[model samples]
Target: MTGLRKSPRRLRIGSERGSASVEVAVIAPALIALLGLMIAFGRVTDADAAVDAAAHAAARAASLERDATGAQARARAAAEDSLHGDGVTCQSTDVVVDTSSYMLDVGQAATVTATISCTARLSDIALPGLPGAKTLTATFTSPIDTYRGRQ
Candidate 1:
């Protein structure tokens, strides 16, 4: 019995030492990249919503105007104000108002269309392979008062 005494199973402490650190080192970059991607996606989504709202506002503003020139100017201002109020900072912003409806005679059904384009900056995210900026565009149409006079 003494001669057959079982040898104790040896635990290899050194083999597992620093393993957690190694694992973290290997996985940290991937986790960081994933988080960055999520942030980028969120930013893009928010910008899209902002642009859409801007277009809607612009179209509504334009539809309320009685003349083509006034409609264009009001639409641009409304779009810009909407985007700014939404905290969307764009590298370049373009607002196009189609006011052909204003030429329609009074009591005729017509609509105004507004298109807004914003170049949102993504470089702040600092994600590799991500575009420095993305252009978000939205278009909206609003019906003008059928009984209202138009020029």
Candidate 2:
């Protein structure tokens, strides 16, 4: 008994052997969640940027020749290039060009919509718990009438 009492520190240390795991269990999830959210948000922002770039490109193209198909195509290419140059898929089969305003109108902006998905990986344990991945869509509008070209 005396020896055991003398080694009280050792016993205390031994009791907490799995305590690291406990601490990790409590904290790891929150950390993982934060990280996942950040990654997801990053992808969302990137997608938005791509859409904006696509819209800008399309509007510029439309302003030149009033060709809706070409404008949409340019926008899609630009957006795809934004995402590692993998090529973007336009959300709609038809690239709607609101030529109603024409170049003479104050607001001759056209809308382009695209969807992009990104894969984010986490710890193996967290993978099943977290959403596998998310597909994000973004719409961009640019004013064709306001386009001056070559600033």
Candidate 3:
């Protein structure tokens, strides 16, 4: 006698065949888009850090000057130099220096502020209604020595 009666056969892989490939095909575009976004974000973050460093260098350079005219020139040059050294190429770069503190009376606390704006080109990251470039701005302030003689 047979130990057990025969049971109805069930097919486990009949309908689900190639489902993994289908799922991957459906999700491939989304995954690619996510990766692209991450790469773009990383580039923007690096540019932001470079711009901040440029601003800081500009502020420091301007703070060492004794006159507003020299400070402005130095700040602009320093900002450009720093950005270039950091391998950040900007399509358009602007440097602004606030020299109001330079006019303060001697022995008073003085501060110089430098603001840098940079528009960097993106790598084929074009979207509808979105520009292919990103503008990053940074501002830094540095204290001028109170004991230093002013012009």
Candidate 4:
């Protein structure tokens, strides 16, 4: 029985010391980068929604006017107001209104289209592979009342 004694296993504790810290140090940067990308994507999506809303507002405002000149002016104002109210800051903005529907006679079907372009800021995030600014454009069309008179 004395010759059949088993040897004890080694703990190997020293060899594994600081391994967790090394793993954390190696993985931390990747995790941070992923989080930054998610935030940037969210911001872009929100900006797109804002631009779309602005376009819709512009088209609706234009459709309410009876003259081409009035439609253009009202559409631009509505788009600017919508963007400002939504808290979307733009480096530059452009609003285009299509008021050809105003030429249609009363009782005819017509539509007004509005396009809004906005440059949204993303440089503040400081994420690699992301553009400093992204231009987002949205277009919307609204139908004019068929029975309404147009100039």
Give me the candidate number with maximum lDDT. Answer: 1
The total number of steric clashes, by the backbone 3 Å criterion, in model 3 comes to 0
In TM-score terms, which candidate is top?
1
**On a 0 to 100 scale, what is the lDDT of residue 129 in model 1?**
100
TM-score for predicted model 3 compared with the true structure = 0.81
Off by over 4 Å in 2: 1-8, 66-94, 103-151
Better of 1 and 4 by lDDT: 1
Candidates' lDDT values, in order? 0.94, 0.49, 0.89, 0.92
Clashing pairs in 4: none
Between prediction 1 and prediction 2, the one with superior TM-score is 1
Using lDDT as the yardstick, the better of models 3 and 4 is 4
What is the C-alpha local distance difference test score of candidate 4?
A: 0.92
TM-score to true structure, per model:
0.92, 0.53, 0.81, 0.88
**Tens digits of per-residue lDDT for model 4 on 1-151?**
9557544433366568899999999999899899999988888899899999999999999999988999999999999999999999999999999998888889889999999999999999987888999999999999999998788
In candidate 3, list every pair of residues with a backbone clash.
none
lDDT of 4 at 29: 89
Among all windows of 10 consecutive residues in model 3, the one with the lowest summed lDDT is 2-11
Q: For every candidate structure, what is the RMSD over all alpha carbons to the true structure, in angstroms? A: 2.7, 6.5, 3.8, 3.5
Once fitted onto the true fold, the runs of candidate 1 whose alpha carbons sit more than 4 angstroms away are 1-10
lDDT of 2 by residue, 1-151 (tens): 6754658788799888999889999999788878877765665566556555554554445445454555546654554455444243433322334433342433434332333333322333344455644444434445454553211
Model 3 spans > 4 angstroms off: 1-15, 127-131
